[model samples]
Target chain A: MEMTVLIGLDAASYILTLLLVCIGLVIIFGMMNVVNLAHGEFFLLGAYTVVLLQQYALPFAVILLIAFVVVALVGLVIEELVIRRIYHRFLDTILATWGISLALKQLVIVLFGPGSQQAVAPFAEPVAMFGITYSSYRLFVMGMAILITAATFFILFRTRVGLTARGVIANRQMAACLGVNTRRVDRLTFAFGSGLAGLAGAIMAPLMSVDPQMGVGFLVPAFLSVLVGGTASPLGALWGAGIIGGSNSVVAAIWTPVVAQIAVFSIAIVVIRLWPGGVTGKRKR
Target chain B: MSGYSRQLTVLFWAALIASPLFLDGWNLGLLSQLMIYGIFALSLAFIWGQGGLLCFGQSLFFGLGAYAMALTTKDMIPGIPATTLTGLGLAVILPAVVAGLLGLALFKGRGLYGAYFGIVTLSAAVIAERLAINWSYIGGFNGLLDIPPLRVGWGSWQTELYDPLPFFFVVLVAALGIYLLLLRLERSAFGTVLRGIRDNETRATFLGFETAEYKAAAFAVSGAIAGLAGALFAVQFAFVSPAILGFALATEVLIWVAIGGKTVLLAAFIGAVAVKSVENVLSDTLGQYWLLVLGLLFVVAVVLMPRGLLAPFLQLPLPRALRLSGSKEE
Candidate 1:
């Protein structure tokens, strides 16, 4: 019973992390149509930021906030310089972003060396609830990711900016004609998406090994999540992430972890063939 | 101008055929590798330039071809032929089958656009690599080595392909055959319909042309050629690995096609050889900085010579060169 409880808590934490990353991807790919293959790099940047800030003996909350702001600024710069030009040509954007990803990876290698850096977790204790022992850091990650995802949904569904962004996604020309300032919206949306990715990276740093190539392992799954969750819908992102995360956890518990990843991709491909609009149905107008 | 162009073609073929005789053994080997990659790049051009389908997973077909050849050469099953001919046959057939099935599944969803197509194909390549790595039967990460050289006969006096000369000739013949086949296909009615589809898919659909079928056919043809190249690669390296299906290989082929100028098949071949030769020379000198150079080259190519290196050669203002073509009209 104790082992089962531990497994369930671990699974829940993993699902929450997947949910946060997928939410960021949905905003970037679904709303912006800017297939940022370098989304993982943004996550890496956030983690590094936290590591750098923590070295100065900053509080965990301050480190997280600084990491978020700095990474979001980097996202804005990338949008203005690189992504803006290739918005109309989707394939070109993918290739260019891949180039950026490679460059970012090399940059990280240059800065951090070719070794994995250990991220120090702020909370040292394990929290026990109902006979289940879970790391405090993991519980913190779950709470933060859930809160952020909820806040994002609220802003996207209720705010004027979100409505304008939605209009632009639905019909760019129509949105422009209505004086929506689609260009500004594009930049903010990209930055916001990247910021979320960065936040995920910072949050996940304590759990996983941080290295130059860490982003590569996560990139495909994030893309799989985006593809399986209709490309133009937020609810789809959540559903896709939940399915992938849950299945992966269960399969990994039963079988090998590598097999579980392969199963995730296979299931994604099968799901795509069966429901091209994704599991969340069509995008809402 | 047309006569001059014909003369140039003649000169090019003559140089290509005589190159091995003049070049050293290492150069000959490199040339053979380039020729194989040339075939791979041309396969991409057939789909991307002509068919308007930007398939980022061409490496899947290439790796499939290599694995097929590797498997056949190993004669995994006792009764299967261990000859190079059998290797080549399976290489062509397997990729075609895989591409046909994949194309059917992917081409159905309102085209899926270019980015999605790229992502899906990339995902497939990653999955394939992972599967190969996990399954030791396929040789895994270390790859299959010590593949025997091709033999032409059963007993004494059989020709061995261990030497670079024989291998070069084999690649040349295969490349020539594929080029001719592609040329013929380009001139056929089917080719016309494909070009029509590329230019305007909806209009072609309205005209009763089966756009999806034509795209699938083109994709299959591309896969077949890529597989043939992969087979040649296996023989040349005497090895097979999952790296052949990697994103790096796929992107390199794209760069070759882009640099060569996708307007003509011959241009793609020239581009592939030229780019590989330059990289080989640069890497010998620059070492780790080679990728940095390549990244810069990609950027320059996109910004400056969008049509690729061939554009300047074909369109240069050489005094009366531009006027030469119109002279006959005058």
Candidate 2:
């Protein structure tokens, strides 16, 4: 019973963090209709920021914020420079972002070498929960993920910036006509998405091996979440994350990580085949 | 095709044919490998340039072809024969079927357009790569090794293409065959219709054409061609790894085609050869930084020069028959 509860808690944490990691992708690929292949690299940049800054002995929360800011700034620069020109060209955006992905990967390898870094997680103390001892750090990560998820939901549905962003997503030309500064929205949306990716990277750094290729490992799973969830709604995304992340975490605990990967993929393929539109997908007829 | 483009195409082939005369055995072998990649690039050039379906995970098909060849020739499968012929056939067929079905599924109903299709393909490649890495039967992360080369003979008695010169000709023949085939298709009415669908699927649908079928068929043909390239790649490489069947190779090929001219088959082929050749030289000097250079070039190719760097030299003004009536195109 105790073991099952612990496993359940772990699974919940995994699902929540997986959602956190992929929400950025959801915003970029789902909401913006721009396929940012470099989304993973933003996450990578975030993790590497933690790796770089943890040496300064700053607070973990401060480091996470810095990671978000740094990556978001980088994203803003890219959006302004390369992405602004290719907004109308879907295929070109893919190639351009892929180029960015390659550059960022190489840049990391050039800066950090190919080896995995040793990133230390904060909050080493164990917390007792219902007669069970759990790592407080893991719990903290879960809390942070939940807090961020709630905050993102609040901002997206509640804030004026979010309203403006959604208005742009709905119709860029219309938003521009209505004085929404669609260009600014595009730039900020991309940066905000990238910032979310960075925060995800910061949180996941300690749990995952901090290598140059780590972002790629996270990318496909996030893609699956968005693909299966449908870009139509956030709740749909959450459900998709739950299915994939939950299965992955559970299977990883029970069997092997490799099996978990394969299993989740199979489930996704099956789900996709059965309902091609994803969870929020509707019939054309 | 215009006279200039025809002459350029002919000259390109002639130079390749005459290359062995000046080049050494090692360079010949390297050129052969690049030719296989040229074939791979042609596959993308056809489907993306002509068909207008930008497959982000083309490496899935390439990798499948390689693994098909590797498994068949190495006698790894329980029931299948281990002949080079069988390997080659399966290599061509497997990826085609997978891609055809996948295309059909994705193109069915409302249909997945643009980035949706690419992401799906990308995910497929990732899954395939992971499966290859995890499956111990296929040798896991170390990958399958010591695969047999292309053989020409009756069943029992066969001569392996061990010599680089002979293999070079074989690969050249295959590449040229694929190139010519793609060019012929590109000029065909089918190619026009494919391009029509690409330019506007809804309009094509309004014209009573099943755009999904067209896309799926184009995707299948592209996969078959890519598979053929992968099969040849396996024989030349004599090893197949999970790396070949994933996002890395997919993106690499995408870069080659984008830089070469995705719209022009010849340009894409040359782009692959040129990039690979340059990498061979730069790996010693720039090392990992070469990827950064490639990334920058890719971005430039996509943003400022969508026609690709080599398109000016390789592409010809299309004749009237290939163009839609009353449609103006440069």
Candidate 3:
């Protein structure tokens, strides 16, 4: 029974990490019209930030906050300098983002060398819950992800900026006609999305090895989640992530890790085919 | 066709056929690889330029072709020819079948814009590469080796196409055959309907043309040609790997087609050679930064030549001495 609990906890930690990343992707691709293929790179950037701060023996709280702000600023720069000009051209955006991803990956390689870097947990404690042991770090990551999601939902649904963002999403031309400042909304939304990804990366840094190609591993799952959840709903993104994350975890527990990844994508393909509008409600044109 | 235009086509074919003689072995090999890529680009142009399907996972079909060829030779499957020609046939057929099935699911979305189309295909490529890497029988990461070369006859005096010269001729002939077929298809009434569907799918659907069917057919044909190119490529390289179906390779091929200008099939060939030749030079000099240069080139091409490199050539003004617009003169 104890062994089973240990296995389950391990699997849950992995799933929760994936869920957080997917939730961030839902906000980026589902809300904004930007198809950010380089989103995983942002996650990498956040992890690198945490690593860098740790090198200087910075506090974990400070490092996490800095990671969020740094990644958000990077997102803003990308939006203003690159994504702004290529909003309407989807194919061009895909190619450009892929280019950015390549550049970021290479830059990481040049800075950190080609090997995976180890990250140390700032806090050393195993939290005991119901006679089961859990890493405090993993629980913190899971809790923070949930908190961020809640905060994002509140800001998106209950705030003025959130309303303007919805207005822009509904119809960019109409939103501009209504004097909603669609450009600012787009910039802010993109930054918010990148910040969320940064947070995920910073938290995940301790659990996984930080490497140049780490982004590629996360990219497929995040994309599958966004695509399956329907690129139009945050709630749907969470649900999609849950389904994918849970299934992948269960499969990995029963079978090999490789099979789990394959199973998730296979399921995603079937789901997308059956429901072209996605698992969530279709977006209104 | 105009007499001069026909002559130019003949000259182009002649030059391609004789290129191996003038170029060194390594250059000839590179040229052969470029021609295979050219064929793949031309296949993409048919779907993208004519049918308006922005397929990003063309590497899927290319890989299918290569794997089919590789498997047939490596395993010595019965009923499938061990020869390169039979490998080529299987390669083309499998991808066509897969594309036809995939198109049914993809074409259902009402507004399958370029971005979504690209993402979906890219996802497929990712899945394919994963499967390729995991499945060791298909050579996994090390790839399949010792693929036999093409043979022509049963007995003595039979030709074994091992050297660059014979392989070059084979690719040239196959490419020319496909090009002629594409030319004919482009002029057909079916081609016009495809263009009509591209311009306005709703209108074409209203006209009872079954736009989805046309798109699927075009995609299948394109996949088949890409498969042919892949089979030829496998033979040239004498190995097959997951890299054949990588996103980078797919994107590079698409970039070549886009840069060449999708308006004309010939431009696909020109673009493939030009970009690849440039890549060869850049990769030799810049090492890892070659992709950065290629990426910048992609952006610049998108901004300046929206119609692609072929646009300037098509838009060139006629000389005052030969200004007969309506006449079909050479």
Top TM-score model: 2
Model 3 Cα interface RMS deviation (Å): 2.6
Better of 1 and 2 by TM-score: 2
Candidate 1: residue A214 Cα off by (Å): 1.1
lDDT (10s digit) by residue, model 1, range A130-233: 78777888889999989999989988989988888888899999999998888899999988888898888998888888887777778877787777878767
Checking candidate 2 for backbone clashes, the offending pairs are: none
- For model 1 the local lDDT of residue B174 reads 85
> Could you give candidate 2's per-residue lDDT for residues A1-285 as a string of tens digits?
788888898899888888888788888877777778898899999999999999999999899999999999999999998998998897778889989999999999999999999789986788888668888878888888888888888888999999999888888889999988888899998999889999989888887789999988777888788778877766566878898899899999999988889888877866765666678877542
Candidate lDDT (C-alpha), each: 0.80, 0.88, 0.79
- Model 3 lDDT per residue over A96-203, tens place: 676677677767776787789887888759888867878888888778877877888898899988888888998999999988888898899888898888888898
Candidate 2 off by > 4 Å: A273-277, A281-285, B1-3, B78-81, B155-157, B323-326
RMSD of each: 4.3, 2.1, 4.2
User: Candidate 1's residue-wise lDDT over B1-330, tens digit each?
Assistant: 133544555566678799987999888999999999999988988887778787778899999999889888888646778887888899999999899878877776455546667777777888887788777887889888877777787667677678888888888888888877886787677776787887788899899987888888888999999999999898888998888977668877887877776646777878898889988899888765666566656645643455667633432122343355463311
What are the candidates' individual DockQ scores? 0.37, 0.65, 0.38
The worst-scoring run of ten residues by lDDT in candidate 2 chain B lies at: B321-330
The model with the greatest DockQ is 2
